[model samples]
Target: MEKADSCRRAAVEAVADVEPPRLYEYIESVLDRASMVPAALTLESAAAMSPEDYVFEDQDGRHCAGESETDRDRTQISEYDSERIVTHAAGVQLIYEGLRLTRSLAHDEPWTVADDDADEGDLAILAADILVARGFYLLARTDAAGKAVRTVQSFGRDQTRRAELEPETASAVGPDGADSAPDSLDANLEHDVLELAVRAGAVAVDETPSPQLLAVATDLADAAGTSFPPVTECLTDLEAKVREQSLEDSTTDRATSATDP
Candidate 1:
């Protein structure tokens, strides 16, 4: 009875220490469901603005302007109809950076394990920590994008007219008298690449679980004159449980937020 209890405890503790897999899942979901237009435009703006301070305004009243004055009394101000595009570009970059961190972690070597006999619980804990970190990282990334999108949309919605007299405007009114921003698909592609990289990193981690190490744990338990079945079974069950719980929690939170006043 004592041995059985010990095995059960180890199994439970090991599983408890493993972090839920929902972090990656949530990030992936966001990437999948997000609006490609704004995200792409945002990324394009970030890239274009990398070397200069500029703004975008449209011919149809979607105008954005920026001004910078040198210490030598030279004032450089520019505007465009695509300010929202630029803002979205920056926002997408922020999200990409956050997602990159998780990808980096997924590729990094296990921090807690050195030898074959290391505790399974320790390994599980390390994995859990990585997942938790990823979750927070992605949440921050998505939040930044979300905030920027809202701000940009608000600005676009509030603007009543394009900067008609601004000579710096790149595009002119179309034959149909409609204004359009530059193509933003390139920026969207970059964001998509980042998201894909993140997913790939997660797949790598999931595929590379140290099965040998788990086997070693089983061997060790058997050598200690104990049954290994309970420990292994418990760890497996815990992993699934953690994943399910994390996903459920994430879904619930999203639903609640959507319904909230």
Candidate 2:
């Protein structure tokens, strides 16, 4: 939880540059509540984890900082896994919320420049900063940091369009063919973040990243829409596929060795 918690705190620190102190404090509090989604996902997975699934017999099924002959730390994690995606997803939500608040000031509306709206805009901008900071903090050190970084950049590009939205452009806020608010954007962003997490996890474990992982992440994201669930069955399937592939590779190598001169 410490790595997870650190990601959230980093987001607040990011707010310091653009948000007022009071507003930063407020966003910090909001962030605390918003981060529970990923945490819950991890806890649920651990709860379901059978002892035979993990390496060490006594390992608590908790996130560890790193792996060594003797990895004893309880507060940090050495491997990048799905949990990082949760932190990143929370950051995405915080940033998107902030952007929405600030976008209210765009298009030169009569009330756009009002004191309250301007203040809201400031807070929104600051919140986004925090999200980005938190994202980089949680992801930059990972093996799949590049994938996550590119995903964040893509999300930023999407934000540009959203932030520029005016009254006439309200249609863009909804999905392509739905009456609901444009949940697609959120789903797509989340999918990318989660996909990168999958890719990164693969790399961490020395597995070759596969197209199926992307497909699984994207499919799960689409299923989630705007309000997604904590974790998904696809994640389990993806892990199973990874394990299955590893076994086949091992068997092939053994057979090849047996036949070699």
| CA lDDT of each prediction against the hidden true structure | 0.32, 0.47
Separately for all candidates shown, the number of backbone clashes (residues 3 or more apart, or on different chains) is 14, 7
lDDT of 1 by residue, 125-203 (tens): 3444443333333324432434334423432332212223223335576676534432121123233433332222222
- Give the lowest summed-lDDT range of ten residues in model 1: 200-209
Name the lDDT of candidate 1.
0.32
> Top lDDT: which candidate number?
2
Off-target runs (Cα >4 Å) in candidate 1 are 1-83, 113-261
Best by TM-score: 2
The TM-score obtained by model 2 is 0.52
Per-residue lDDT of 144 in model 1: 40
Clashing pairs in 2: 64-77, 65-76, 65-77, 65-78, 66-78, 174-182, 175-182
Question: Where does candidate 2 stray beyond 4 Å?
Answer: 1-21, 35-113, 159-186, 203-210, 230-261
